[model samples]
Target: MGRLFMLDVPENTSIVDVARHLDDVTVGRIGPYMVIESGDSVSIDRRSTDVRHAVWYSCVAGIEGWRIAQWDKDALRTEPR
Candidate 1:
């Protein structure tokens, strides 16, 4: 399984939206944190999220059972660990 945890702020809401839009991905919440889960992997495009640079760079609050495949100003891609 792959998972990413993020702070549930206004700027981060789009992250959850992106995760939920992906096939087979689940979106959950732990207090103020948004948890994104997938049986495979999770990849969220920064552009699609429409967040500014600060939010984009700091959106990932935690990662579990996954590795960052790519993270630039363009996108964030993760793979099963």
Candidate 2:
């Protein structure tokens, strides 16, 4: 499985919601990190989250076992490293 880490903040809540909607993806917390895990690539739509540009751009705090496949105004995609 691949993992993505997002910092716990008001603006990042939607990211968690989006991650939860993916098949085989699970969302959990480690300290202040919102850990998202999945067997395949994971993606989240920026517009669906409704977060402002600043928050959306800085939402991803770290990555574990994954690399950024795509990250833009439209979406964020992470794949296995």
Candidate 3:
């Protein structure tokens, strides 16, 4: 499983919204964190979220069972570790 914990904040709202709508992905709350989980991988397109670079780079609060394979101007992709 690939799990990503994103900080719960206005700057990250779009990212959370996108994650909620993805197939095979689950979104839940853990305190102030928005937990995103998937059995295969966790991938989010940067353009889809419309977040600025500062917000995009700092949105993640934590992660589990995965390693970030891609995080750039294009997308944020994770692979099981």
Better of 1 and 3 by TM-score: 3
lDDT of 3 at 79: 91
The pairs that clash in candidate 2 are none
| TM-scores vs. true structure, each candidate | 0.93, 0.94, 0.95
Ranking of models by lDDT: 3, 2, 1
Per residue, candidate 1 scores C-alpha lDDT tens digits across 1-81 of: 877999888889987898799999999988888999998867788888888989889889998999999989988989987
Error of model 1, residue 76, in angstroms: 0.6
lDDT of 1 at 71: 85
What's the C-alpha lDDT at position 48 in model 3? 99
lDDT: the better of candidates 2 and 3? 3
Query: In model 2, which runs have C-alpha deviations exceeding 4 angstroms?
Result: none
lDDT of 1: 0.88
- Whose lDDT is higher: candidate 1's or candidate 2's? 2
Writing each residue's lDDT as its tens digit, candidate 3 over 1-81 gives 778998888999999999899999999988999999999887899999999999999888899999999999899999988
Q: Relative to the unseen true structure, what is the Cα RMSD of model 2?
A: 0.8
Q: Which lDDT tens digits does candidate 2 get at residues 6-30? A: 8888889987898899899999989
Runs in model 1 lying further than 4 Å from the true structure: none
Compared with the true structure, all predictions reach lDDT values of 0.88, 0.88, 0.92
**Residue 8's C-alpha lDDT in candidate 2?**
85
